[model samples]
Target: MLVSLIFKRTYRPNVNTIQWNKTIQNHQSNGNYQQALKLFQLGIEKNTFQPNSVTYLTILDICKELKSLPTVRKIHHLIDESKNLNNDDIQNNPRIRSLLMDVYIKCQDIDSAYKIFQSMNERNLIDYCAIMTGFNHQKQYEKTFELSKQIPASIKYSSPVLCTLILQACIELNKYDDGYKIHQYGKKFLPNNKIFMNELLNFYLKFHQEKQALDIFDKYQNQQTIIDYSLLMKYYNRQYQPDKTIELCYRLKNHSHIQIDHIIYVLVLQAIANGCCLHTSEQIYNQIKKSQTHMDINNALINMYGKLGNLDQAEKIFNSMSKHNIVSYNILLNLYGLYYQSDKALKTYHQMCQHGHQPDDKTYVLLLHTLSQTPNKINDVKRIFSTIEEHKRGPMVTAAMIAALIRAQLFDEVNDLLKKLPKENILFYAMKANSNETNEKFHYPISITNEQLALYDLLMSNIYTYAGLHDRLTNVDEILYENKILKDRLSYSWFERSNGKIEYFKSEQLQLKTCEHTEKLALINALDEQKNSSSPILIGKNHRTCTECHDYFKKVSLSSSQKKVYLRDSTRFHIFSNGTCSCEISS
Candidate 1:
C-alpha cells in the first residue's frame, strides 16, 4: 500500500509516508535510472517542498542522473532553501545522510561528500561501507585503506568489496603478502557462496598466488564458472608457462562444460602464436567457426590469419566484417605491407579511412617505408607532415627509415638524425653496457674512431663472408660502415660475434676482385648522368654490371633489355647496374 502510494501518480502530504518514497526507491533499486529520474521530477513538480527529507533526496536522484555539477549545485540550492535540512535531521537520519553522500559523489563533488561525511552524527557499517566505496571510486586509495582500518572488528566488512580494494592496492604496491591475507578472508564467504568463491579465486590468480587460485578452483570443481576455466588459462599465459595453462584448460573441459569467451580464445591464440606452431593455431580457428554458439569470432580469426601469413584468408575475413574496426584494418594494412603487396596495402589504408579509421603512426610507418623507396614518392616525409627522424622514434620504425635514408644517399640528413639520438638510443650501445670489459679495438678497429672505415670494413667483411657483394644488395650497411667520423663509439666485446671475412678489407683484393675501382667509378658517372634524365629503364643480366660497373647505370632504369639487372660475382649480386634497377623504393 505504501509503495503504491509512493509510486502512484498521486500526492501524499507526509513525504515520509513510506509509500511515497517507496515508489521512487523501487524504480531506482531496479536500475531504472531514467524512469526514476522522471518519477522524481514529477514528484517535485507536484509536491510542495518538504523540509529535511525524502523530497530533497528525490531531487538528488535526478541530479545524480545528470551527473553535472552546475545542476547538482542548483539542486543543492533547493536543498538549502528547504527548512527541512537541519543539523538535527542529518544527525538523526541515516537514509538522508547516505543520500547526501551519494549525490555529491555522483556529481563528482568530492569536497562536498567529505564535508557531509564529517557531519554525520550517527554512522553504521553500511554508512561506512558506502563512504569507503565512494573513496575507492574516487581513487583515494590511502583514504580507502584508512577508513577500512577504522571499521571495528565486530562489524563484518563485506569480504568481496574490501577484497576488491585490497587486491587493487596490493597490485599497485606490489605487496602480495597483504593481498594474500585478504584472499584468506574471501574463503569465509566461499562455502555456500560460489560467486564470492570465484571472485576470491580470481584475486589469488591475479596477485601471482596461483597455488591458492588453483586450490580454490579444485575446491569448487563441481560448480565452476567459465571464469575459472578462462583465468586458469590466462594465469599460466601471464607466467609464460604455456604448457600448464593449456593443461588446465583441457582438465576443466574434461570434467565440466567450459564455455570459452572471446578473451580466453584470444589469449590461447596469442600463446600459440608466440610459440613455433602456427599450424596448431590454424586448427583453433577452424574449431571456432564450427561452434554453434560462436556469436562474435572475427578478432580471433584475424589474429590467426595474420600470424599464419595467410593474407588471402585474412583479407576475406576482414573485408567480410559488418564493420571493420581499427584493429582489423590496421592488421590488414600491415600484413599487406609486410608481404610486399604495396598496392593492396594502399587500397586497404584507403578502405580503412573510408570506414572512418584514421591511420596512426604504425600505419604511416609501414606505408612510408614502401613509399620511401620510389622516385615517384621520394618526398614521403614532406607529404606526411612528419619527418623521417621524428617518426622513426621507435627503434623498429627508425630502422626502416634508416635503411631508406641510406638508400637515398641523404647522408647529412641521416647524420643529423643520428645526432639527435642519445648514446643509448644506438642499439649496440645498450648491448655494450651489459657487456664484459674489453679493449675498444675489438669493437671499432681504429683507436681514433673513424665511422666510415669501421662501417665500410664491417659491410665489406659481411658481404665477403655471408651475404656477399652480389647478393642483390643495398649499400646501407656498406655506407654506414664507410663513414669515417663518429661522435660516440662503444667497446663491444661482441663485435666479433659477426664472423665476417677479411678478404674484402684485404688490400690484395684491389687487383683480383671481380670488378675494379674504375669499373665502379664509370657506373657511378653513368648513374649521375641519368639521374637528371626523365627516362624509363629496362636492363638485364647481359647488360648488368658490378657495384663498380653499375655506378654509371643511373639511366639503367632506361636499360632497354630486361626491366631490372643485378651485378653478379663469386659471392652474391648487387641489384643495380646504373643506379637504376627494380628493387628501389625500400628493401
Candidate 2:
C-alpha cells in the first residue's frame, strides 16, 4: 500500500505536466497567448504539476507576446527555485536563458537581458545575437559596437542577422570606415546573402556614397527586392535627381520576377510627378486603376494629376473613394487652390468639415492661401483664421494671414499684425520688406544667428523682386554675393514624349539668350514639338515662375494659335490657354 501511494504521487505529476504542456502549446499555436498565460498561472497556483524546461520556455514566450515584464520576472524566479524542487538547473540550459533574454528585450528591459547574457555558461551565436539585438533596439549603438568586438574569434563568419545589426550600429555611430570594412567582409564571407547585401546597400546610401551603392545595386540588380529599389529611388529623389528616380522606376517595372506593390507604385507616381511626365503618369495610372486600390496610391495619383494640371482626373479619383481620410480632403483642397478656384476650395472645406474629418494645419494653410488670392474672399479668410486654434497659428499661418491683408490693401491691419510678431521671426522681416507702404529700415536682430542670416537675405531678395523694388533687390543681391551666399538656382524643365521618353532642358542649354529663362526655353521646345504632336504641352519647372516668365507665358498663349501650355512651377501649376492663366492675375 505504501509503494502504491508513492508511485501514484510521482507518476501523476508527470502525467499532469505532459497534459499541461500540450494544452499550453496548443493554445499558443492557435495565437491564444492570453489563455495560455492563464493556464500557466493556474498550473503554478495549483501546484499539481512540475513544469519542465518546455513549460518554462512556453510560458516565457507567452510573456514576451504580452510584454508582461512582471510575469517574466516571476517565471525567472520560479525557474531559479526549480533548481531545488525539480533539479532543473537553468545554468545548464542555454535555451531557457536565451528565451529569458529575448523576453527581457521584448519587455524593453535591456539591463536584465544583458545580465542573463553575462550569466550564460556558454555564450553561443544565439546568445550574442539576443543581447546585441537588445542593445540595438534600445538605441545603445555604442554598446552594440562594443559587444561586436567581444565576439569570439573562433566563430568564423558572422551570421547575416548579426552582420545586419552591426551595420546598423555602424550607421548610427557614423562609423563609415567600419561600415565599409563590414561590406567587404560580407562580400567575401556572406556572399549572395540578400539580407546582408541589402544592409550593405543601405549603409552606403545613408552615407551618400552613391557610387558604391550603385555598384552593389547594379551587381545585385537581379536579386534586388522591392525594398531595395524603393530605397534607391528615395535616395535619388532626395538628391534631387528625379530623372534617375524615373529611370529606376522603369527598371523596376520591367523586372519580370518583381511584383509591383502599392508602396512601389506610390513612389513611382511621386517620381513621375516630380519629373512632370504626363504620358508616363497616365500609363502608370491606368495600371494602378486595374489593380486592388490602396488609399496611398490614390492619394499619390490625385497629387500627380494635380501637378500635371489635370483637375478633372484628380476630382474623379477623389469622388470614387468610398472612404475619405484627412489627407484625401487636404489634397483636393490644395488642387482647388492650385487652380485658383477659391469658391471650390471653400466648398470642399465645408464638405470636409461635414464629413467629420477635422482640418489639420496643412488644410488651414491651403485654405488661407486659396482665399487670399481672390479679393472678395478676405472676409472668408478672416472667418477661417478666427476658427483656428491658438496653438495652430504659428509663423506659417500668421505669414499667410499677413500676405492676405496686404493683398487686400489693409496696410494698417498688416502693420498691427507685424508688430505682434517677434523680431527674431524671419517671416516678419520678409513681410516688412515686401510691403511698399512700409518704409521701415530692415533691422537685423542679434538673435538671428549666422545660419539664419543667409536664409533671411534670400527671403528679402525674393520679396524685393516681387514688390518691384529693383534697387532693394540689387542691394540684397550684392549682400548675398559678398557673403558668398547667393547660389545659381539654375532653372530647368522637362516634358514627356509620346514614347514615354522624358526630355530635359536647362536654362544654360538654350542657344538663344532670350530663351535663358526656364519657361521660355520650355515653350520654345513645346512649340517645336507641337508640329508633330497634338497633345497639350506639359512642362515641369524647377523654380517658381517669375513675373517676367508669367507675362511671357501669357503673351505666348495669346499668339500661339490656341496651344495650351501646362507649366508646373515650384509653387503651383500654371495652365495657360487663350491668354488666360489658372493663377489669379495681379493688378
User: Which residue pairs come into collision in candidate 2?
Assistant: none
TM-score of 1: 0.59
TM-score, cand. 2: 0.78
Residue 72, candidate 2: alpha-carbon lDDT: 83
- Mind giving the per-residue lDDT tens digits that candidate 1 earns over 356-471? 88766566656655454344554653355254346446643453454445555665775565555445333233223323463232233233322222333222333332334452
Relative to the unseen true structure, what is the C-alpha lDDT of residue 551 in candidate 1, on a scale of 0 to 100? 45
lDDT of 2 by residue, 343-457 (tens): 8899999999999998876788778877777789999999999998766677656766776776677868877777666665766765555456675556544233322442343
Residue runs of model 2 more than 4 Å from their true location after superposition: 1-19, 50-52, 76-88, 91-93, 108-123, 131-157, 189-191, 358-361, 375-466, 470-490, 497-499, 507-516, 585-587
In angstroms, how far off is 466's CA in candidate 2?
7.3
TM-score of each: 0.59, 0.78
Clashes of each: 37, 0
